[model samples]
Target chain A: MQSIDHHFLDDYACRNALRGIDTRIKLILGLGAILIAISADTPYAPLFIAIILSIVTVFCAEIPARLYLTLLLIPASFALMSVIVILFLTGGGVPILTIPLPWLTFTATDVAALNAFLILSRAIGGTCGLLFIALTTPMIELFSILRSLRLPDEFIDLAMLLYRSIFVIIGEAVAIYNAQVMRNGYSSFRKGIIAISMLSSSLFIRAWDRGEELMTAMDLRCYDGKFEILEPKASLTIYHILPVFLFLSLAGILAFLPLPFPPL
Target chain B: MHIMEGFLPSPWWQIWVVLSAPFVIMGFYALRRMVRENREALPLLAVAGAFVFVLSSLKLPSVTGSCSHPTGTGLGSVLFGPFIASVLALIVLVYQALFLAHGGISTLGANIFSMGIAGPVVAYAIFIAGKKVGINEIVTIFFAAACANIVTYVVTSFQLALAFPAEVGGFMASFMTFGAIFAITQIPLAIIEGLVIALVFKYIVQLKPEILIRIGVITQERAERLREGWA
Candidate 1:
């Protein structure tokens, strides 16, 4: 709701390169990697991918690695929580690694170790890869890619509307939430609950009204189902294709390569 | 619970990614139309998404502070239809994961499909059903929120179960078990969510009567109540 954050969401960096790359290709490459990373047996692969992606994001996409790393805590904490449980629940196989923690025991089998390692790495790696792609790419272009890929007409149309309306509702939510923060001092535990509960109630109304206002406006516009105007897609360029291909190929080769034991 | 990275089997998330292909296309097409029709509304959607995002930052009364983020699908579905809300939920889950590392990018498809799509749709469907049953607005909202919460947890549990294997009931058992553990928090949270939805609806209905008429989002009971207030 702050003016600065609102401005940040609307930003589309790497505009020139972004425009040049076919939206469809990026979707395929980006989404495909997501699939690959999620399915892999070990997190090492995604970690490998993440390393490569961090490089690409910095060098090719020109996004700051620090900015990206800062966002990582959210996923890292989640992975840690799950992995810790898995390490405990999944123990009793061959003990690959053993660690003693304060009031917590961590003894695991090879499978669990592999599972823990893979899940952690893949989740973290796959996520970073996505962030790299999403930040570098624009939402509209991503939408166009959806169109080119033959998404359902109804589905795409709905996204456009929701995407448009979210900000309006957020303004209201922020206003209401901020008001709660002011009243309740959103820091403490007890007050936070009341604030959150109130925010929930308030956000629903605002989002609804916002949606209705949008619908009315559209109704006035001689609303047909068609989205008449669109950002034109750039023609295919070998320059673009070559990079995506190289990236995928490199990831694949890394997957196949045999790394030495204690893969440092 | 937002399943973190390196947790669920990649095969499951991969299958979900495959399923998302069609939705991604549809989502983009929707984006274009939405841009043409409803550009002004996006900041609100972003804000709502951010609001939920910020809620995670707040750390409410859950035993696991970080694990229990609020589900906006019911609110989103009630306000913006599920189709749009589903995408918003998907975006929230993805960005939360990517930006905050809250959830995994791989599981995002499944996460969105379940919590995002299933929860909102279930809530909307139940709300509509409650209307037919002549339920009051407050109760209707509560019922819908409860159902959405339960459905979201149930679906996520099943998805998680598929990642593991059980001898007999398999995912069905996992679904119920996870539901049991989390239901305590979810129960009150769902109620809170419902009350929130109801109040917001009440406020907005007061502000813009035209919107309810156009989107047909409001209930007859609530509309009648608003009319009584005016009288």
Candidate 2:
């Protein structure tokens, strides 16, 4: 099937929605998914959810399944949380096997085999919910929700600046790092220091000037004390309600069901 | 050291996390003011945030394939202060949760408290102490980051203990033990974090004289002299 990552979706997906359901509707559904995925006792629900996610990614995101899988799935290797813990802890439900000589210890002979499957589904389930929200929502609209929610101005401001800066500052650091590689690479720890020095010096000077600029911009916008979200479109309707209920129902049903496969 | 789903029941983490939502809202309001007040600082904050984000995403080898990323908040804390750091981290955590699923939302309050509040407040206090004590600058930065790392984990452990009480001992004992598990990974991470902080600070001191003034590491008078001396 298709890869689950939303990051590699086609430009068409980013530019236009397949269904283009109301943001609130998608948001509600996605949030409901998060709760359901978290509560599910059995792993099958998550796997099913993952499969659904793949279908959505393929049709809605307009990305080729293979490329998406290669780019996103490969990097997803970072999801393993406790392969060692399960190996030594009876894999929770798996049978135990012990080793002796070096030190008397315990392990599940099938722990590796089981955990790989378990963790993958868990990560995929949780990940799909998040991707749905992120890919569908634009940054400004996302902030708009926080504003409508009556969030504090201070936190919003921090996000505003931090978000604006992520791309800028990263660009500078990359340039510095590129220069460093040209000279010595990170061949030695000492060389790494030189690269850091270059990065840090620019980091400070840039932040100071930008801080003053940001304050002025806030004053001009009549920012007041509270962070006011410019009123939303007020166009929400049945579109929002349906997806939310559908996703919630799907996840809720999964939470109560037992896994057909073994726990592993 | 991020806590994931199923580690603790949903009810506990959810209630605490939801309770803190207002605090986050208030924090947002405050940061908006800072932004309005310090528009010039936008580009700089971006660079700082990006520097940290990129630097943080780099994995450090410790126990085999398990890699711990730096929060990189030592300097962010030292310069921005904990309140602002709280705002910054809230954004970062939210993005990470929604995008990467590296941490949990039910633990957002807990995350902010540990990484944002604990690290910055502790790091700032120590840094100020070192400066007042007239300790070496590089050492001060390194020491502050090192202390921050330890304190952050200790606080995070307490957060975990609150959620998951072990059967072996009472809640408090279990809390301490839970904190200890992270302390194991954090110790080496702290040392490396310290080294990185020291190196970055040292490099800044050498390459960009203007930053010293902006960050308050040097007074206006000192900055003038440095410029005059160079001239």
Candidate 3:
């Protein structure tokens, strides 16, 4: 089973030449693309954005095509489910199809279909923007950005510790899960629940102990109440900033371009 | 249960982000106070946040005989308070978005509102009310956990409904549709979460009653009485 806490893309990000690019530039550009994608009134605009973003992410960022495809599909089930609901609930505008059911009548209209398409495109576009950043930037760099933003010390410290402890706790949970499997502790559903409950309870206790030990260690090191870590200085050049400006300008241009299809 | 990326249109997502801001700010204040009062709480809260993230990842057998993940917010809310639970939940949500691709950053504010603010607030309320009514400790824990899980989905449904209301019946119809769709899975998951949380609460009471006392979830006298009974 793939570990939920692990990010395969982060390793790629570390190796990618884009790792040295300023995180702030990436953050702004990514967010700008997402905002444009979301606010785009027409499906064509978002569709264009999604394609361009995908090309940049997979090619420029050196993210594996297979990994990019997998990440894009992560939201498929959710987006499909909501789109289905929207299709069913929305009505009026040249009925495409209708189905009579025992409980309720269902109708699909052109407007509804258009709405679903818009949602799908926008969602994909927004996801592409997010993937571009997540696939290219490491969490430490993101955290450093947060630090540079001058967020609350407590918030940053807690986030740092939480990030570190995730690996530790996941390791502990996996160990217990393997031990349980070896013992056939999950042979039945009831047994599985029992085993999982025990696993969680034990994990909680162990995490608490770990936290205490961490506190003691930090204190031994003359730890102040606040945590302090050095932030990496990112070098930004015109070469790095050019792509962002170009992308933003391209998005703006696409937004104004007339759509071929009739407005929904 | 998260609204997907770009799921909510412009104004709705922004509205949720603005609404959720106060709770997150309050959570910051609560965290600062806790750390100031007890330096040890800093690490404890971090570990607690990690516990939430890990626990949410674990797929447990639901009452419907299907596997589902528990939210884990309720357990944290009971152990800590709602505010700190909200902060912990935001961290967990951010991690999930970054690594698991389970949720998105664009909808982070909405996710925080539902999973972090609404769910934990409801859980905290239920816990307080259940204690005031002198309910069994385990039963109260069960209600707190179960209600929190259910409320998170409920709020999510509302968020979705508000964003994409039905053309004919409007928000109510869409809300009902979303609610019914999620209820099929979430109800059973919530019950299982409740039971698991209750069992964990029992284990903590038996093994580390002092934690409950220290967190002010239970009074020192109450902890002593419970320990004496177990003894």
Question: What ranking emerges by lDDT with the best candidate at the front?
Answer: 3, 1, 2
TM-score of chain A of each: 0.80, 0.76, 0.92
Using Cα atoms, each model's DockQ against the true complex is: 0.26, 0.32, 0.66
Give the Cα lDDT of each candidate: 0.61, 0.60, 0.84
Predicted model with the maximum lDDT: 3
TM-scores for every predicted model: 0.74, 0.76, 0.95
lDDT string for model 3 (B47-156, tens) is 98999999888777765533267899999998888999989988898887777667788899999999999999999999999889988778899999999999999999
Who is ahead in DockQ, 1 or 3?
3
Candidates in order, interface RMSD in Å: 5.9, 5.6, 1.8
Task: Tell me how far the alpha carbon of residue B47 in candidate 3 is from the true structure, in angstroms, after superposition.
Answer: 0.3
In lDDT terms, how accurate is model 2?
A: 0.60
Model 2: lDDT of residue B182: 58
Task: Order the numbered candidates by DockQ, best leading.
Answer: 3, 2, 1
TM-score, candidate 2, chain B alone: 0.84
DockQ category of candidate 1: acceptable
